[model samples]
Target: MKSSILASAAILAASLEPVAALSEPLQNILINTDRSPIYRYPTDVTRGIIPIPVHSHNDYWRDVPFYTALSAGCISIEADVFLFNDTLYVGHEESALTKERTLQSLYIEPLMSVLKKTNPKSPFVSGPTRHGVFDASSGQTLYLWIDVKNNGEKAWPHIIKALQPLRDANYLTKVQNNETFVPGPVTVIGTGGTPLSQVVSAADRDYFYDGPLKDLTGFTSLVSPIASTSLMEVVGDIKSDSENPLNPTQLEAIRKQIKAAKDKSIGVRYWETPGWPIRLRNELWRMLWKEGVALLNADDVNAAKEYF
Candidate 1:
């Protein structure tokens, strides 16, 4: 009887091995990008069933509760860097400052540790496999959407200098001609009425211009024609109003804009949409997906993961 029991136990363990191997242990995964956190929901109303613990953002990095939402494999991550004095800190705006929350401490340090463990030879030793989109031999390429929150002329040089190490390693994506102006690896995405024409012309680097959906017609026609080889990311800042719960008109406008941009082979993203609140997010996603938008930026990763 003891011999029989031992054999049975061994057989059970062997049977379960494949299941265990197939299950990917969640370790800081993001659906589209690695910058945001993943959250979990008890039930998914849209799917008519409970999901396997959807991943979403948790402010746990800020002494908030650790949410159980699993990661949905984020391809890229965005970190907004503000250079104060000589230090670069990660925050969306200038007001949210804290001594312990420097860019290295908050975003770079932890991310580097993760990358080192996963892919030891990564150029970004501070964060490994975080941005898995680029070739390893080419070095890890991070979009590094550096929003020039400060003085563009002064701050731009400093930002480039700071990230010079990565550029030397060929980890940066650069435009053919404008190497001097728009430095490598870091794509300058402007916000709050930033004039990108001079920047694009001077640096010969591609950029993301934030404007209304309709306003994109002129910009795309003007910029894209001359810079045929250049890339442009048009970001539409749309919001929901009382009259429109999901902003159907804005969605339609975005669709048209994306179609036009695609014809030119440019990228697009819609910002300022409600990130959480499952119903609203799903609706927005459904619209964007239908329009064939490749990238979806979300403040919360888990909310975005549900649709996928």
Candidate 2:
């Protein structure tokens, strides 16, 4: 019986060797050949990436604005736009602004181009599709935070005008009849110096306002899908050395603001978080996630991506 068992094991092992030998060469040929059976979808650019709830704070500061955040699987992006001669220029401040890098050049056009590729006019597709930038989650609407600088009333109009191409493509999310909401590939949110009166007054607008995190009296997801505020401002200085980074008072403040936003179905994001003392940063991130903060404001998406 022992001899028969040994013979059976030997036969099984011998059979597996031929299959292993065949697989390696086939894999190599597939890797080298153009005729490989692997097929890709229209928006396979972000095929393997998993979308995370991190907001890429000051996204224009990155080497490649939109593409960098998109590649890192960041669902939110912020751009500081300064209106100059009716052209919306993207920069952190007036000194950084240049003629070459307008909102159209940096964000609007690039997003349109990507959307065009994703929503290809192919016979295989049944109808018009509004697939977003992330192929992993086609329905995820990217938050495009436009921080209007200086003249908001003036910049606001130019920002709207610059979004024409995306508007034409039906890519901007809309709130029709001041009530009915329609989700699209991109959700343009007005922050910084953006005029609240202008945003709320519009009976039918494609854009939204970045509501105050602490105050959500009249704002809802209709006007502000996501609300934001500085963590330092709201919670005071975080004492990171201890087990509980945030003191009792600071934790309560955060919870109150988050609860207010949650009550109105609005997402919450806190910026100006401490980036130093790696341990503190990680601890804060963990606490925020545990406490149900909708989006994590991350200056370093690479680190945030790894943390998630």
Candidate 3:
């Protein structure tokens, strides 16, 4: 009985060895047979999403600032920044600022994180890459508009310092040798209280000025890649029920502004467009697109996304 038991145990062990040996190879075959090799590019984060020529107005108001606009396919985003104790705070007003919501926390750091992912280091990669947020269009550059809420001169330095992370990563679009405008993943435009002198003086600076759309005499892609103006200021208020949304005068103004900016190779954007009466708002959007507006300034990204 002992001999028989020993022989049976040896047979069982022998049988299990073949099963264990086959298991790993069989599993690998099962796992890899139908699936292709996994590969990923740096800008794959925004894969499958098509970008639109829309500016996310007051972008920080969203629950997820950078990501919200990115997901919505808005190529441009804005943040209102105020300097307090040498720290850059982001909000529409001073009352809206919180300690946690900062220029670094809200925009710079987040942008760096996204850019880093889009420009990863790998053996397969030959050299440096400047991939933008959009995987569908890797050449697309995200526009970051910084509106200085107060104390332009005092706040300017802080804004520059805050951008070091991006600058170090070569993620910010720059004017090299004061002539070559090399576009990176992100372009920073200083608006509101941002001084024109400061931006233009530094010919090779990464940041640019949001020049007056109504007057861009000396501005170029180097100093002002994009120019913006209020729609009401330039085109006047639209009558709520008027079939001719943009009258002859307003139409001419729109064409002139767009032509002026585009002639200088600078894009044009119009803010403070009518919001209420959904029909009129949509009609204006259509008209703006028809007029060849570079960016459609939109407070509501979801609605704007739907429009496109």
State TM-scores per candidate: 0.55, 0.88, 0.86
lDDT of candidate 1 vs native?
A: 0.45
Alpha-carbon runs more than 4 Å astray in model 2: 1-40
Give each model's whole-structure lDDT.
Answer: 0.45, 0.89, 0.88
Per-residue lDDT of candidate 2, residues 1-308 (tens digit): 99999999999999878554467877887777655435446566678878899999889999899888888899999999988777888999999998998888889988998888778788987888898988879899899999998799878988888889999889989999999999999999999999999899998999999989978888889999999899999988788788789988888888999998999999999999988788888899988888789899898898999998
Ranking by lDDT: 2, 3, 1
lDDT by residue for model 1 (103-183), tens: 556544443333333333445356532222222222323333445566665655555555554444433444555433333
Candidate 1 Cα outliers beyond 4 Å, as residue runs: 1-71, 108-142, 178-198, 201-214, 217-251
Clashes in predicted model 2: 0
Q: Is candidate 1 or candidate 2 better by lDDT?
A: 2
Highest lDDT against the true fold, candidate: 2
Clashing pairs in 2: none
Clashes of each: 21, 0, 1
